[model samples]
Target chain A: MNTSDAFHRYTKKVCGQIRWKKAHDIVSREIENHLHDQRDAYMAQGDTESVAEEKALLQMGDAVSVGMALDQTHRPSPQWAMIGLVMLLSGIGAIIQFCYYDNALAAAPAGNISIARFAFALPLGILLFAAAYFLDFSFIGKYPYLLPVALLGIDIVAQLIGVDFNGKNWLSIGRFAISPISLSLPFPLAFCGLLYHFRHKRNGYLLGGLFAAFFCVQLVCFHTMSGLFVFVCAAGSLMLFAAVRGCFPGNTKRLFLLFVVAGIVLFAMFLWANSYYAYRMNTLFAVFRPETDPQNVGYFPLLLRNIMEHSVFWGKGNPLEIADYSAILYSGNFRADFLLTFLSYEYGWGIAMFLVLLLTGFLAFGLHKAFRQKSILGQMVSLSILCTFAGEVFVYILNNLGYPLIAPIALPFLSYGTTALLLHMALAGILLSTFRTGEVFRDKELLTFLKPPLFQWDNGKLIISFKG
Target chain B: MTMDKTLLAGSTAMLILKLLDGQDMYGYQMIAELAKRSDDTFHLKAGTLYPLLHGLEKKKLLESYEKQTDSARIRKYYRLTPKGKKHLHEKTEEWEVFSHAIHQVLKGGLCCEHI
Candidate 1:
């Protein structure tokens, strides 16, 4: 047989069985290169091309066994602990939804219509998560433009003529009332993968920043007010990711310019548009002086404070009923925002604090895991996802605690929105696929970090130990 | 002495880690170096080496970065991380104990009549 044929057979046997098909190309190249080197060495020792090739192929040993070994080595290992934690939170979310639904039906007469958005969320989340976890995430980078282009097209069209909900902020699809926000959620993720993949090329970051800025502009003009904050944070993260990776050589100026432009536009739009967005800023007053606006926007902050103060270490009280989603929903009550409040009331402060720790630990471990990725694109996407997650969680918790710099960006798995929950699970799946090859955290640091130190000696041993 | 194929495959990771503790090396460089250093005994194959290298990286025992040569070929170089260095030390210690025991058995020091 020809050298090419032998080489092809060798690689096919080696990489064909691997689940992460994206790694196959690199695996084949490395093997082919090795074979060529061995063949060249034999040729130097007075062997003909075909003879050298045969000898080289012979030295590789059995193709089937080698392939199997490789398959075993590169097989993806799911981070089950992290997956379990996310599932636990989602379980609590489901229970919360059930509880709210029960109470809402009891409060209403009888014929109130229940929103089925969350009914499909769990099943859809499972499907999307499984698909993302099983498939190679590198495909996102491979066909990057497909998702971003489609989303932009949809968003632009939605902005132009799509049916509006509640004074032109949210765009809903025909008949089924599918929110355009849900459709646009996956674009940032795919865009970051492409950016990381193309960071080395000329005009890469500039072009990426330009597209991103244009997208941000579209989001701004489209007035996806609730989604606009998430878009800003996600897009900002991608830019920061590019800057840190330094993938775009000498294009920092253009990126910075785009950031400033988008920043100004988003800030101005927030000020000009949504009153609820404006109401969130009044949260600082609620924290410091609760009596200032006792009747208005100060109610949530003061209510949260009261809940914390009256709350036991383990909650013995009933779950707090906050947002009356019944007016909007046809049937069940919408507990859309108030995640932390619900956690404290239902599971108690103990479980709530424990979950807070879990969230922090999970994201920290994810960020650490991303650095260990051998693939630059994996690292980039991982960082982008982690940053977006971190930003949302931080803002969400802070907003709950009375420093509401951002509006109610819902908690990841615990939030009530169908689209938010589905997107969250899918992001987790992508994160899993990225860190599938790497250790989630190193050297038992998580346990140590979570555990209170045995020693409290401030003389020399124990410094500041952080509580979750 | 000839070794079992499974045994050779098993030792490749430790052998690669052992080689890498001294210096960083790329794929082809590693193959050549291992052959040269082992006097062609271990005979590390390239097909197995890349996957093994990648596995080690995933375990956080190694880190890699790419550099371009004057000839413009991108070369991926692997080095022992701090975690990897600590792991290598432990592996070396284990190997020393295991090999010493094996040597004792081979040198007619152990009684295997029961077996």
Candidate 2:
């Protein structure tokens, strides 16, 4: 073989052993550079070019053996620890549901359906998680609007033919009913991609803002205020983050101020127009001082306070004996919204604290790893998921503690509902999928063209210059 | 003089990490530096060194970056990561204990009286 082509031939052979094709170019380049350096060093010691090349080629050893060694280390790295944690959380959810059914079923036989539903949902959620975990999440970046648009389309259809439960619309097929609110949870993740796709374009924020507004209007139309709140909070934070990171065209601080003022004024007007919402806001305030509305809106808060106060640290606490009120406390709603309080009441504050700590630990671990990722798409998508979990857990804790600031959102994996469970598992899968391929996957579309360095040093004097 | 393959293989990663503990170096530079520092007792081949460096990087013990040298040649330099430094520290301690034991055994004297 010719001397120059010999090095190329060696690199090709070495890279052929590496099964992951993406790593081939990188491995090839490094090996080829080393060969060239070796050749140059030999030539510097007075060998002819051809002799130097021969010596350098011999120094690299067997191509196949080197490649085999490299192949072992260059394989795809899956986050097994994170995967175990996710499954652990899912298992905890099942145990909590089992506890609820075992305790409350004799009192309310209707609780049997929930147990049956849980059986069905758990497998389906796992199946979806598996699917999402293997899924290349970059498609969200490729088609940024696909998830949000599909969700909106589903919601629209649900509004037309879906079943209504307590005035909120849910898409139902057979025994499984998919809450539109749960469907809306992925909006922020999709928005991350949407923002990324338009980050470099002029007037991209305008298009992005309209897309968010459309989703908000749909949620408001369906009267899913909790979903609307989540969608806005998560999407708003993403937009603000993008703006601050110079993803948007305008001044980030000014745009953020404008959005805050606009949101407050609109929210106030809505409250002024809607007395029911206004009353709910007042009830939020009156929760701490339950004596003001003891017979009415403050009733639940007072009961919650009484239950928490009476609960012990480790074992079962004294059950409230207010007749029908206690019966209501043992219903399915208690399993979904007041899970922490229910657990505290039945088990103890210790178990509740354990659950809280476990959830916090998982979220903190995810946030730390996600933030460490260099890819922008991975960071943005993970931020959205982490924010959703943090927001839900925060709201759930407040509502359970008797504040009732907003309608209680499910505590992610811990809450009891088929669609909610399925959605959360799917989201978790996406998160794990991101962590799995984060190091290798790059969103070429989102990558900005780096300008040449504008600052340089000449003769040890620092020079700064501007670039056009 | 050739060292035992297994012995060389076991210590190759430790030697490479120790070299990088001083400063970042390209593949060829590491090979040359190892020979010089070990007084020609260690002669790491390009094949062995590159794979070992890549393996260390995969474990996050090392990180690589490219920089243009004075000759305008872009060289891929590998440096010890914080994790790698900690790993090297542990390996160094283990090696000292192991070599000391071997020395005592070879001399027919137990410097460490426990065994």
Candidate 3:
């Protein structure tokens, strides 16, 4: 056999039997054709048949290497990951529907299940199914960057239908009965995907334009302090990533122009959309004199007092529960507070600090790997996610201390919401993808923790090392 | 003249475009043409050639289709698009202007003596 044929045989042995016929067939055919060509070339060079074949095989390198390279090319794309996400979300939606509406529906007159409940669950369930189905077909893989835009469309439709027909809050679908925030999980997932895509592709103009449009739409549609905060944080994080990654084009003048335009538009939209910003501004300015607005600003003091009075250094069972209860008792906002109450109340001070350290350490590790490994995209995504996390932490801390006017964004991994789940999952996906790139921490030495100890005592003497 | 290997490698697209200006060819044929045109001076490595061809194909600058030769061997044939031709022409003109300017500066007034 010629070099190509030898290489093909080697590769087949290395890769084992590929289960997917289409992929396996294509790879096998390519190998066969390549070997044939190499054989012909060797023969034309006037070598004996055996010698030519041996020489051809020598030129093909190790079979395993060729098979690995081909496998890399044929590796399934993010389509599978997307499908998994959609299925997970659908499962979550089904569970939520069954839990909240099942008993209520059974008790109600037949066909009179609350419009609010149905409105909240149906669009969300449909959205999850549609996203999953679309992902399975690989429709969104080509334009992964556009996934967020599609999600935003779903959120808009869900919000419009929920509010107009069901008379429910955009976030909490019914009267504290059922929430559609789970449906909004796709938005954050899509956002993470977009960030990943843009990091690799660096289409700054498109990203900038999309952010601007999203900000404008959020301003018009919701006009809530929470909405404005989400828009600002999301847009700002993307822009920051773009800047750090050197994806944003244009030197000083152009950069200045873009920022100015963004600032002006954001300021104008904030002004037009809601008056709550004024309250937030006033509360921020009067942080020390929180008692002036006791019901709003004083909520934090009351919660802190409750925590301090109720338990010791570690405080309650879960900082999250304490925070939730405190919010309900003091601020009358039973909605889960992302940072302040959850961290301090549920995990308590010590555990919360430990959790924070662990999270920060993981993020730092991801960032170090991303940058050290020369993955600009990974670095950008890590940095952007880090910024979001930082902002969430900051807002939560401020809200806990005294700035209750600031809207809560659920703490990372601590809050139980669709957005939080999607965000964490996306973060996991990004880190995994970065790992797969083989840019970071590939050396066995870096994973020394997983290995057995370097030395072991045996019969009163120390054995230096263990053999592999 | 000694060739800058890095420069030649970097300008492989230009070299490929220049070669394809004369004829359409399959990957192996193009590789052979490159070697022949350069008087056996250059051989495109498989690792580099496949990725470059794939990239070009992705960018729509080149289109490929399979055809059976007289020997009944199926070969993938690649040809430049109208857009590719225009891009090649523009890049060629730019490269010529750039090289001429560099040559003039490097020669330090000996350029006119050669002319």
Question: Individual DockQ of the candidates?
Answer: 0.23, 0.43, 0.01
Instruction: Quote the TM-score that chain A achieves in each candidate.
Output: 0.75, 0.81, 0.56
TM-score of chain B of each: 0.88, 0.91, 0.85
Runs off by more than 4 Å, candidate 3: A1-57, A62-141, A144-146, A163-168, A171-207, A223-231, A276-278, A295-311, A315-335, A338-348, A369-390, A416-468, B1-115
Q: What is the DockQ of candidate 3?
A: 0.01
Interface RMSD of 2: 3.8
Candidate 1 local lDDT, residue A444: 23
Q: Docking category for candidate 1? A: acceptable
Best candidate (score: TM-score): 2
Q: Write the per-residue lDDT of candidate 2 for residues A1-468, one digit (tens) a residue.
A: 655479989999998898977668567767877887889899999998799998998999999999998898887568788888878889999888876754343222123346667787799899999999988877778898788777778888888987776676777677666766567677778777887888757877776776666666666676466666777778777777777667767776657764775476447545643558768766876787887988888888887777888689989887676776577667876767888888888889898899899889888989998876646788788888887777778878888887776776688888766677888999999988888776655556322222224675754866564641
Please rank every candidate by TM-score, starting with the best: 2, 1, 3
Residue A434 of model 2 has an lDDT of: 82
Which 10-residue span in candidate 3 chain B carries the lowest summed lDDT? B45-54
- lDDT string, candidate 1, A1-468, tens digits: 657578878888877666666557556655766676788789999999899998888877677767776677665677898788778877877876765643343332222214464566577887888777766666666677876776767667766766655344334432133345444456567668567656667877657766665666565565454355666677677777667766667766766875777667667666765556545556655667777886676655666665555456775544335443213222333245556655565557786778678788889888777876756567767877776677667767776565544455567777655556777888888888777743222112222332435555643755444442
Candidate 3 chain A — worst ten consecutive residues by lDDT sum?
A438-447
Better DockQ candidate (1, 2): 2
Candidate closest to the true structure, highest lDDT: 2
Reference A-B contact fraction recovered by candidate 3: 0.00
**Residues A133-197 of candidate 3: C-alpha lDDT, one tens digit per residue:** 32321122335657666556655665655443222234332342223323322333345445444
